[model samples]
Target: MRAVILGGIARRVLDELLRNPYRTIELRSARNVLAVEKAMDEALKLFLTYDPIEDVSTGTEGLLADLIEAKQLEMRVPWEESDEREITVCRAKVKLFGLGRVVEVERRERILVAKVRELFPHEMNMG
Candidate 1:
């Protein structure tokens, strides 16, 4: 299942997004587009490999969605900006084996950071 997803469905999805010239306004500059492409690929890899799910979930889409959002947010940073702009990519709760887990992925200065933590069953009951 994982192989099928990464090799087929996910691959097609990534390819489509990469090929879409109008995907985002931030890709105007070739330099920025290349940077974003690299980041997008990284985001997909992180999503597919993290936890190794047999089927797709919102988490998968969320990571990509958040990455795009991060890029949009990054554009507002002035060219002269020096400080790192930390953007929240994904912070979602996913159920595995009926247990809830939190998936957090963030972007800072074109770098992607991701982490997953198994939630205590009781944690799932909270807000």
Candidate 2:
């Protein structure tokens, strides 16, 4: 359950980060980044070995839904201007801020997409 929530948070964070474009956002949380990274790895692994389940969706979709239902994921990012922001999130703890370097949005998208893709790609009717 933690992994699932972390996956939802990671996707939420990255998606929010990318949408801002040309801004430096500090993602702070009580949950360490290792949990988020582990979630990503596990998500990728699931995509790699997913068994088709009729009328159901797999991968991050379910995670996202749960995050939405649980209200653990913030849909709107807080905007900061002229100064760096320090936010204390209640969901999880994290000391590692992955966006410290401030990469381009395109590159960030590529990195995220690559990270989420299955190790072995195959057509699955997860529904």
Candidate 3:
């Protein structure tokens, strides 16, 4: 299938690029780029094996696998600014799924903060 061909090539390219550090100069300072690319490559490879109808479904399933790991960490630990940081960090892992956009994450965090404030108005005193 088309996806299988494309995905196979992409995976090969990614593997070669990763194996050759010289190719990652663009990502020298931003290691997250590598992580994002790797995830995308994986999603593409997985997409290749499924029919068009199953593509979206399988992609979402793979994406959720990443998200569930993040959620587990979020629940297991005490909430702190660092926890927020962890969420942001974990979000990068799902970027390849095309569903975890930065704007969406920001909006979600803002909504969560607002809800928490409403539930505990006095928890943080502006004064």
Candidate 4:
């Protein structure tokens, strides 16, 4: 799948490259939005595994990121759990950029997003 770098994320990625010389990452815009959405829909099913309504807005931030990053394109949800009344599902599609001039992130219950560069854990050089 082809991807696109939003605006300014090159320098940060370059710096990261220096740290992890062996690591590699690529970003490009999606060739087809509909297809991505379709894939995301299928990916959403994986959320059910973390069920127990009380768990919403809980942990599992990495679940979504890991799925798309892991490339789990297809999944299944039980028919009984498909009903909104039985289970409420919330999801968002996120794209990770290999680099960025500045990373904008919001972390409360979980890592809302870490766009353009490294902003996870927020311990070192998080400014």
Candidate 5:
């Protein structure tokens, strides 16, 4: 496993991961989108975690920045969990840009995209 820290208290997290007795994961950092694409080319699984930013509507509260799509990714929800269903599966894909090259990365897993709608009602229109 590999851990990539992209800001937001990353140094503290790096310290904890480095202390792992098993040494099972590798630590990496991508300073920019181009570097991130290079890292993705060599990665088997990519996990993106987010940190919220300040929002005026919330009065000092922070909300996750809306940058997924801006990062050359697309998320599609075929269905959502409801009383009739117990599980919701989502598909997410990202396009990595290299030096005059483009690579597409895809992952299908159990993710709740519906929550995004609740969080960004003004920005999300899943219709």
Candidate 6:
């Protein structure tokens, strides 16, 4: 069986907000879409480094679904009060076993930050 650890980008954004509340509006702006896209791309790159999935395999699809589900769950149980202007970002950290012992990381984002590692998973020490 495989194991998955889930987390959201909202947490990281929230932390940033706590440190600099003024950026909240800017973070949600449409202009930040590229940043968010880059973040997702980076996340995918990180995932593939450990677990490379091909076109036909359902692994990528399933992993994406799991990541989205995890994000939804995280939203349902917010660590702080929900705000209308606040956006939640979610992602997953997946572990595959058996013949393919690999780890995958996925991330969702609402804003583009120059240095955001909130959704990135730590290096796995286990094999």
Best by lDDT: 1
lDDT of 5: 0.25
> Scored by CA lDDT, what does every candidate get?
0.32, 0.27, 0.22, 0.29, 0.25, 0.27
lDDT of 2 by residue, 1-127 (tens): 1222232233444454335422222334433233334444554211111111221222433211111111133333446542534444324322222221111111221122112322121332222
lDDT of 5 by residue, 7-120 (tens): 222334323332431212222222323323433554422222322111111111111211122133323434564333222222223322110101222221211111111123
Residue-wise C-alpha lDDT for candidate 1, range 2-103, written one tens digit per residue: 111110123443344434522322223332334345545654322222223333332433212223333433333444674744432222221112222325
Quote the positional error of residue 121 for candidate 1 in Å.
3.0
**Model 4 misplaced regions, further than 4 Å:** 1-69, 84-127
Q: Clashing residue pairs in candidate 4, if any?
A: 3-28, 3-29, 4-28, 4-29, 9-99, 9-100
Q: Which 10 residues in a row give candidate 3 its minimum summed lDDT?
A: 110-119
TM-score of 6: 0.18
RMSD of 1: 13.9
For residues 49-110, could you state the per-residue lDDT of candidate 6 as single tens digits? Answer: 12222221222311111111112112243546654434544332322211212333322343
Deviation of model 4 at 82, angstroms = 1.3
Clashing pairs in 1: none
TM-score of model number 2:
0.20
Error of 5 at 35 (Å): 4.0
lDDT score, candidate 1: 0.32
**What tens digits encode model 4's per-residue C-alpha lDDT throughout 1-127?**
1111121224564345335533333333232222234435454211111222232232322111212432323335577776533322222234332222223333323212222232244332322
